[model samples]
Target: MAIFAKRALLSTGWANNLRVEIEGGRIAALHAETSAQTDDVSVDTLLPALANLHSHAFQRAMAGMTEYRMAGRDSFWTWRDLMYRFTTHLTPDQIQKIASLVYMEMQEAGYASVGEFHYLHHQPDGSPYDRLAELSDRIMAAAVETRIGLTHLPVLYSYAGVGKKPLETGQARFGNDVDRFCMLVDQAKDALGNLPEDCRVGIAPHSLRATCSGDLARVLATHGEGPVHIHIAEQPKEVSEVMAGLGARPVEWLLDNVHVDANWCLIHATHMTEDETQAMAASGAVAGLCPVTEANLGDGPFNGPTFLNAGGSFGVGSDSNVLISLTEELRTLEYSQRLRDLARNVMVVGEGSVGQTLYCGAAKGGAQALGRDAGVIAKGKLADLIAIDCQNPALCALTSEQLFDGLVFSAKDEVVTDVWSAGRHQVRGGRHVARDQIVSNYQRTMADLLAKL
Candidate 1:
């Protein structure tokens, strides 16, 4: 198949009359200043679709449920209790329904893939399903149905707190010791039996408070070159606990202990000190930042200026799925930094506009974290692209060079008109192909689940 865009962002910036050829879900070749072929699909503008580097699919059904304050002193701990209660009721069918809606929404929002940090492994009663990969299979089914790329990060969550503690009651569904966790991962691979080449399997150590160092090492041994992701210091309470238990801050301890590198994605290292920031930057790992969720949870903003100045790489995610928007996440990341430094354009890389810098940086980091040959519109890469409706009055006034700035900052409407995920046209006219069915299932599932609560 071939697509011709009047304007497109290429490896060498914006080009006109752009022609991209795709074969078997990968870009075959690209040509600039080319005439449209008779069979080519035409588009206004083409942008590289990005990966949502972190997500919890089931949480999408609970986005607005926890918005109100439950108590006078609402915090992440309190919000988590609600999450635990919510996860206790979902059946495999309901899980698939929620995930299908979530992945379809991501596809429409221009995210070609998601690294689902899945931990809901067992039944509500804390019993393992007959098939260890039961929940994983549901997630994969949703991916197949939605036609979105899946980098399933089966979570290894053992303890509820630091220092090898026992699993808490609310954490029952997520519990698995090292041996069981390994078995689940293996069975997940077997269940993933035949999938698209773009689908990948990876492991996630839920967090420092959720697993011990010994188990961390054991899981890393089983890791066969797939990406590794972990939640680091996202809150002051978490850092305090790590200090009391591990005798160092989370980032400091991990830097000293784990051989962190390009393959690792440390999610929300928000509370790193200056020293820790420098060390993390030098380590070559992508700092997985979900600024919208950080703000939602009142988790402190990461030290973006210092981290980037130290030569760090970073990516954005729709964590919690409370809201899924590429522009919102990227904008929030820069806005938070601007507020921190009390200056504009704090996230600027070098010479380009801040919007372009944020997109390109997050693009590279997101691709690295997902183990995908995407995040760039180039030959031999995955043909994950989005075309925006330039006819929108706000977008229509902008020049090709200024399109990103308008889209990222001031566009007032849903300008995205079409999307392609690894050569699959999952979204058109700003809606997923399977949106009607997925929405119907999701609404029914949510109503039933909420009525019981």
Candidate 2:
């Protein structure tokens, strides 16, 4: 297959009248300054689509229900209690339906892939399913239906909090000792056979508060090849817990103990100290930022400027799946920084387009975090790409260099016209090809879910 774009952002820079060829789900060739062929899929604007590096697809079903304030203070911990209760109502079939909807929405919003940080692994009573990876298989089924590239991170969650605590009732479905967690990982890898070659499995130790060092080491020993993601330092309470229990802050302890490298993605390192921020940048890991969900949970803004100045890599995700817009994620990131510092353009590495820095930086970082050979329109890369309507009202007057700025700041997912996940071409005309069926299934599932609640 081939695609001709009037304007495209290549790794080198923006170019005009480019032709991209794909074979076996990877870009086979690129012709710059070229004319469109008769059979090509012509598009208005083309760029490398991003990966949602962190997600809990089931949470999308609970988006609006958790917005109202509780009796007293409301924070991530309170919201999490609600999430745990909601999980009890979801069966494997319903998990598949919700994930299909989430993946379809992601592709339609111009994300080429997702790193599902999955941990829901058992029955509501906290017992293992007959198939250890049953829920994992459901997530894979969703990916297969959506044809969205997936790097499934089967989570290893054992304890409820720091100090090697036992699992609470709400966390029972997510608990697994090191041995059981490793078994789950093996089954998840086996389940990957049902997905495309572009899809693979990785391991995630939910967080420091959820797993101890010995178990984390055990899991990482056998399954350390693909992407390894973990939650770290998203809240002050979490940091304090880790500091009290581990004798160091979360990021500091992990960096010192673990062999932190490029293959690791540290999700929500929001409350890092200056020293921790610099050291984390030097660790060659991607800071998986989910600004929309962070804001929704009242998590603090990330140490963006210091991390960027230290030459860190970062990516964006719809962590809680409360909302899944690429534009709003990037915009919210910048706005959070601005609100913190009382200045604009704080996310830029230097004096350049804030939109470009945010979007392009995240594109590259997201690919690396997912272990994907994508994030740029170059030959021999995965054809993980999106095409947007440059003539859309929000983007009509922008130049090629300013297009990302316009898209990130002024536009919405409606501007995205087509998306290809490793050449699958799952979304077109601003909709997933299976939009009607997926939405219908989700609606029915939601109806049943609400009635049960």
Candidate 3:
């Protein structure tokens, strides 16, 4: 058991100099400012850690690798081909090393948990390993080593596209039929058993382009109780293909086909109409926004104000992981909104600070999307928290709301001084405790991968 007093900020509001008690990796009690502290108590300003609602951990290795334009047009489709080629060379051990570094970076950036949208399964030859969940086990092991709360989402990739076309050679490793996918999910559950109790297993259908309607239905039927995430309408071409092939837009078809609710997350719904945006908002599903990746891929801006007004929810992700920072993601999100609408504070509601509004909304929506009890500093919740350096030049002279504004708008990841996940200290003084070794290993792995490439 341990107790710490701080200016605690809850998602609902704030309390000054509060005492938080922890036991067995969960919050036991929270006391307001007047509470007395014992001699052994420690105090700091505590804020609930952010959840990275979507990530492809392995993609961290491919950062900046595809920047140069090819002879043909460079777009998300072209970039994906490069990604597919890159995935072929990675062994499970290499994946573990890369994911450890990725998770470490996430922890340092004020994210205590990550929802890994894992789709890499099978060997490079498209054959199952002796242990079907070898790749997933590697991810779980990395999560344990990094102490980041993980929601491992095993993806089901049945077909090449909506019409159940055969997978291209590059996609073979991620391909799995319905029965095999169900078994893989079971295997993934067993693989995650070695991880902390807070680690969870969820389901992901890779995208509208990767799974047929029948297969998608089957996978969802098999894992209906767990969180369901899918890539949807990320590009104009994808929207056109879905419309031509399925007679409906991606989100429209999804809402018409699936029983989407709070349990569902539609990643990269970047190219939606106003009606589609409003309908998605009314469906109680989360928009898994990845602003940096969207910008990187030249995907268009999301209709933020309209969606929010329609009662939509959104959570950010470090997709592609060219850069990883919660503040950067939020900043890019707001900046994108400003660029599109030509207005500032475009996402804030009545009587709310822009930064506070963004933070609270992302936190709550991310928690809901990942099916985790996080994003708030409350009793009975997992003790995943971050402490920013209030004394930093960007944060100095800022009140609670202003602090958030400055942190989001002015500061970067360097301001995140301390971090804890599931009541375990993983980062202190703005660095991961195992930063040196993790970085060294990651460097070695990247060198080897590059040598082979």
Candidate 4:
């Protein structure tokens, strides 16, 4: 496959008139200052596809169902209660349908890969599936159907709260003792063997509140080197709970106890103090920020400036799947910072455009978190690429320098015209190749699931 772009965002920076050659799903060569070959497919603007560093694929079906005031005061906990009610009846086939739609949307939204933080493990009756990897296999099948890169993190959710609290009724489907969880991990890895070559399996100790320190250490010690992810400090209540239970903040506990490094992705480190933020940046771990979802859940502002000043790497996720727009995620990140700091371009690093900085940060950190060789337009990297619609009136005047800013801030739907994930043209003309079938399956699944609920 040979692709020529009038202008493209390269790892080195923006370049003009470049061609990318893909061989064996990797970029074999990049020719700059070049004209399109007769055999090349030409486009206007191109970007490296970003990894969606956190996701709950099944949650996509419940996007707008929980918008009402469930109680006097709504919080993440309350929202989670509703989520539990919804997932209580999900069958493996329903999960597969929902996941297919979600991954397809991710590719169309410019996310090449997903770090699926999966925890839905058992039957609604709390019985283990005949195949322990039943749900995990479904997620991998969705990735195969959608042609999206997958790094499945089978989550170990042992407790309902901090300090080894017993699993609540609503969480029965998620429970796994350490031994069973390890077996689940191994089974999930075996399941991936039948999927795409780029698919991977990892371990996620659900959160500090769910996994004890001993089990956390055990999983880290036994699980071979792969990406490790965990929910952390996403709300003030979570921070308060961690402080009371562990005598330290969640990030603080991880820093003090675990050997934090590039392989770890701390999802939603939203309530960090300056010191914790600085330490996290220095630890080389990626902070997985789901800006749109955080805002939707009313999670407080993260200290983005402090973290960035300390040279933190962060990636974006569609967390709740309430909204799935890569541009909106980047826009929400910058807009949230501006709202917090009461200043414009608060997320801009040095002289780079805020959009460019956000995209690059997410790209690099997401690939690191997913343990995939992507997130850059370079030789030998996966051909996970997106082409922008330069003919969009909003982007008509954008120079190669302003292209990212224009797209991130202004252009809306249909702005991205094409996408290739691992050299597969999964999206073209702003729609997934399997969009109709995926949506139809999802609609039927939702009808059945909701009717039961």
Worst 10 residues of 1 by lDDT: 404-413
Error of 2 at 265 (Å): 0.3
User: Per-residue lDDT tens digits of candidate 3, residues 330-431?
Assistant: 999999999998888898765678897787788888888888787788999988888887778888789876878898899988988888787878898889
Higher-scoring candidate on TM-score, 2 or 3:
2
Clashes of 2: 0
- Once fitted onto the true fold, the runs of candidate 1 whose alpha carbons sit more than 4 angstroms away are none
lDDT per residue for candidate 4 within 231-298, as digits (tens), equals 99998888899999999999999999999998999999999888999999999999999999999999
- Cα distance off (Å), candidate 3, residue 387: 0.8
Computed on alpha carbons, the lDDT of every model, listed in order, comes to 0.89, 0.94, 0.87, 0.90
State, as a TM-score between 0 and 1, how close model 3 is to the true structure: 0.97
TM-score of 4: 0.98
**Per-residue lDDT tens digits of candidate 2, residues 116-213?**
99999999999999999899999999999999999999999999899889899999899899999899888998888888999988889999999999
Candidate 4 or 3, higher lDDT: 4
Clashing pairs for predicted structure model 4, backbone only: none
Per-residue error (Å), model 1, residue 412: 5.3
Question: Worst 10-residue stretch by lDDT in candidate 3?
Answer: 35-44
- Each candidate's number of clashing pairs is 0, 0, 0, 0
Scored against the true structure, residue 244 in model 2 reaches a CA lDDT of 93
- On TM-score, the leading prediction is 2
Instruction: Assess the local accuracy of residue 190 in candidate 3 as a C-alpha lDDT between 0 and 100.
Output: 82
CA shift of 315, model 2, Å: 0.2
